[model samples]
Target: MKKRGSGILCHITSLPSPFGIGDFGAGAYEFADFLSEAKQSYWQILPLNPTNKRYFDSPFSSLSSCAGNTALISPQLLAAEGLLTQMEVEDHPHFPERRVDYPAVSRFKRQLFQRAHIRFQKGGVPEDYARFCRGNSMWLEDHALFTAISDHLGNLPLAEWPQELSNRSSEKVQLLREELWDEVEREKFLQYLFFKQWHLLKNYCNGKGIRIIGEFPMFMNYDAVDIWANPELFKVDEQKKPYLLAGSPADAFSAEGQLFNCAVYDWDGLRRNGFNWWIRRFHYLFRQYDFVRIDHFQGLTSCWEVPVGEQNGLRGNWQKVPTQEFFNTMLQHYPLFPVIAEDLGTIGADVRETMARYAIPGMKVILFGFQKEARERSYLPHLHPLNSVAYTGTHDTDTVTGWYQGAGDEERLELYRYLGRRVENGVNWELIRLALMSVAHTAVIQMQDVLGAGEESRMNRPGKAEGNWEWRIPTADLGEVASRLSEMTACYGRAQD
Candidate 1:
């Protein structure tokens, strides 16, 4: 991060695989090799938390912040370990190669994992599994029990469960643990496999001089094991229901603002406890990633606090938190924590000042640079600072090709004026070049932009409820994309080696 470098923003789910969704299998290794071939110094991925398709499939809203997506556990790796048969690995439904069918993938993988778990249990638990459980017990025990109970109760949110269960009464917990002990062990076993496979993949990338940049959401989901196990740390009443929810104030992206059904943090409680939970979170994440991108960093300074029953974020009020003290406590414990601030959207002076004081890098997106007015130039490549990470477009925005195609005449003209080129040469490549050539120390290009994908390939639309986080890359395109990206890297002096 000290030197100028480049990376690709592609979530593991977007990788091509025989299984419906990508995993820490051959596809992940191939992508690491691809990054090495492209001379890329980093590989950025969204959060790897287990997704809840029933609520929202967004990785930001996860079941457990410390848990890895067991859906991402590679069956190939399991087969290699002799836990699964080769026939089981090869035999699969004809899944869509271009996009992930999350539900279909989950159903298929769940059955396979169950078989593997059965085999592991019958044979014997490995020493590594025992060690992993002991090491991560702080959160693992609660998460495993929570997951087992949730599954046993048909996946109901903790708050909606029986009062004894929702409140985590020790007597009820012990009773359920005894009844669901096998399922609890199964959950723990899955986590062990996930981390084991992830470390192997991460080590492979590091060996090739490619570092991983992992994303972390600012807020935890209400239904997540974190809040379920530690209700007192959130804005929840005695019944564990949220009194104040989390969301953003109305902005250009959404006139009604965005309604994120997460519970607002009990800032006072966190401060009184010296932010131990967050410290432990970062401690775990730092071990897994070289650098972390803090999502919605503006919330650290101040956040829009929407009431519990609000339908939209338009009626939310601003609530200030002890941002400086929180970070100070974090730094006191882990001073060298490398972080990238996702400082997009409505930024206040306090947010910018805090980031500057800490020397943390902020994000700059090239897609937002072009405006009819010349005054809006901060996002323009030439105006971008070397301390920031520039991007062609983020996972939340449309692909460069898609944006250009959908842009109005005025926007197109403005883009042309900024880049000093017409769209005929391929707007995606043009913007990719702009990002690489920027003074920003790091540049990240979405996998979709590298392939010149259109609107259909967009990863997310901020306010949309469905049909998001499903984009996948074609396996055949990796080699060519790597070559082109390597050329750009060399030309722009962003090459790793």
Candidate 2:
């Protein structure tokens, strides 16, 4: 954001809700009200794409980049819309409050969704639903068909499916569409409900003068509809299997590097097609969000290409992309690109140059500021550039308190010296204060940090596949921090007037 402002980094699923997991319901509205009370100007969230159990429900590994997660559909909203009865909405089994029970929640929500679909059909499909399908048919139709076929084939991977279906022969696809008309329609109906609810919440936030910041995932899942429908755009083999994957090369963090297991984009193929696929993706995202954060922004300059069958990213080579030409095309399509770059690890000069050329704000995390050496402490609040977006920590890092507790003695001493005070407790607030007071135009605090929560509340732990992306906040804790946050915001000249 160009304007000086502050916001909270809390995902929609992390909001307090009675329906096992959060959705676009009363809880979401209440959160927006809390932001207003806190004098915040923005609300940053993770990707809204659909997550899969196979991927440990991480938002980054989604079923479809274009489709909304059906599990996030609110039964409460359904009742209000006459799609279900109040009793039906409240019929869910008791779910844990502090963490999401994905399986339990999915089963419960799926049942309600089925009933709601039946009701929707009985009431006759509205023109709005038909119009939504028509508007998003570019991706919606293929996604729905892919999902229906996946379920019909007992969740078999597309590569293992019969040659006719995997290749998506026109004759086979037509027959499958006719045979599975009901299932296909059901999938489309779910998506219609998702957008209708999502936009309503977004409008409510906008009315309160708060803008939404959404993440644009860098890679696409191999099993996703986009890859299946447009195989030529990715590095897949003759049988439509991924031969090269996306990941990071071995660096200071890991000796073995990291294997992302996602499909790598063939930049040449994209360039040949005039980047039409990317243009469509950008158009869809801007329509849904006020600002889109380009995740893994370094990949735009060059990506570490890991060959398939490799256990890790050690042997991957850096493949360069036509960064200048790509952005030129994007600018021609959308003159005003409101984007933030996730320029975190090992950012090269080329990446920095591209970001500067586009005037895209890069990120700075306060948690990463406490280094043993002063030269390495560029993330410190005092060093943050005015164009940057500063944070206490991101979803990938531990909560503020957790980081403080786990940091080494030398780092803690450096932090104390930096502040000219040895703070024993409320370290999270100390960092929050520093972030807000920084020269950075925008500052964002994680909900966990705002609550002074510890390691147990950390959102995601990279490298650990399971038990991540399950943290949820208690309903009682939301309003408690507004007064404190408001005073700090006003003191730092970042409050919304």
What TM-score goes with each of the models?
0.98, 0.98
Q: Give the TM-score of candidate 2.
A: 0.98
In candidate 1, which residue ranges exceed 4 Å CA deviation?
Answer: 371-375
Which one is best on lDDT? 2
Cα lDDT of all candidates, in order?
A: 0.88, 0.88
> Model 2, residue 48: what's the lDDT?
91
Residues 1-497, model 1: lDDT tens digits: 87999999999999988998888999999889999999999999999988897755889876687998899999999999989999998988889999899888888888899999999999987788888989999999999999999899899876788888887756998899999998999999999999999999999999999999999778878888888788878998766778787888776556678878788889998888889989999988999999999998988888888998888888888889898898898899889979999988777998999999999999998888863332257988888988999998888888988877777898999887876767665789998999999999999999899999999999888888799999999868578878889999999999997
The CA lDDT at 366 in model 1 is: 86
Against the correct fold, how does model 1 do in TM-score?
Answer: 0.98
Residue 402 miss distance in model 2 (angstroms)? 0.4
